[model samples]
Target chain A: MSILFDIAITAFLIISGVFGLVGSYGLIKLPDPMSRLHAPTKATTLGVGGVLIASMLHAIAVEGQVSLHELLITLFLLITAPITANFIAKAHLHRHVERDQLPDAAPDDCWAVHDIEPFQAGAEPSTETTK
Target chain B: MIEYAIYFAFGCFSLGLLMNLWQIVFASGVGDRVLALDTMVINMIALLVLFGLMAGTEMFFEAAMIIAMLGFVSTVAYARFMLRGNIIE
Candidate 1:
């Protein structure tokens, strides 16, 4: 039974890793930066997080011990991936793409103003930034 | 079984590293590259967890905690720069 459980967990990790691979492929093949962000950010985060969980489960299952280290790492990855992605996207927009160059879509709808509310004043801008 | 799982972990880590390397070399935008860097950091965390399993010790967890915190703070820092062009170092 324990061996069966081990096999199941290993299978789970591999499948999830395949998903991560697909996401990374999307990263390489995608045409635009924004679109590239979409694949890895959403899929890879979940993919890597899934495998991490599997690793944690496998350890606990084999040793009859619980580990919180992987769990905490997963939580941090989930929380941080979006943030770094957001920074990079915004930087690309500001540095390379022009506002006038942007599609005439309602800019407000295009940019999700979460951290600093672009164009707003005194919004307690995020403190964790570096270029 | 764990051996097979370790193999899978190696595959995932290698795949992730390759993708990140591609981004570093070929990606066109700063944001995309930065996102790739974060992904790399996550991969490193995954590697550490695997090491914990191999060693049968919980110390790797501490390293994960510190790295996670670093990832978080760096994301915040990058975000700050993106928004305002300055970070409150």
Candidate 2:
């Protein structure tokens, strides 16, 4: 049993380490900002997740105590990573991309970040047409 | 075996942190720099967890959680500032 736990912990640690390395490498090697964004958000998040899981397993299987604190970090990370990615992507769009450079938005809708008018609360919606 | 694995993980994450530093230094745009900083924060969290495991203590969990929250907030703030020219509006 102890050996099994050791194997599991070792495997997780190595896997996560490799993932973290690859993510960072991609962040450096990727050609452009948008593609670079893809590397760390997905890969490093999984890498950190693996480390967190290994930590939890070590606490439970080796230390003989249940530690769920790592779970909170994991949950927090899972919740925020996508939001961070979205914000970064939006920032990229706003700062670097021109409207015509992008593929067209849906027929009736434009990108929210590019919208000219702020949406008002409890007010009638604007009927302005988007190009 | 686990000891060696821990060492390997340490080396990998440390190298990753160095790479993130390189990205930050040589990035082409503000977004890329922000992305690098976010990656650096994550690598730091991984290192902290590894340290806790090596030292056999749970005390670092709080530190890791705090760093995670701060990192997320800072990334959002940077992105927001880039998007709107201001952080709070």
What are the clashing pairs of model 1? A88-B31, A128-B76, A128-B77, A129-B76, A129-B77, A129-B80, A130-B77
Q: What would the per-residue lDDT of candidate 1 be over residues A1-131, giving only the tens digit for each residue?
A: 88777877777677767767777777788887778778877877777676777767876787778767677677777777777777767776766675566765553544433323344455554668422
Model 2: per-residue lDDT, tens digit, A1-131? 98899999999999999999999999999888888889999999999999998998899898799889998999999999999999999988877888778887887466777875444455675677555
Q: Candidate 2: where is the Cα deviation over 4 Å?
A: A116-131
Q: What is the lDDT of candidate 1?
A: 0.71
Question: Which candidate gets the maximum lDDT versus the true structure?
Answer: 2
> What does candidate 1 score on TM?
0.77
Distance from true location, Cα of B16 in model 1, Å: 1.9
* RMSD to truth, every model: 5.6, 3.8
Could you tell me the interface RMSD of model 2? 2.0
Evaluated on CA atoms against the true complex, candidate 1 attains a DockQ of 0.57
**Highest TM-score scorer:** 2
lDDT of 1 at A55: 67
True contacts kept of each: 0.61, 0.94
TM-scores for candidates 1 onward, in order: 0.77, 0.91
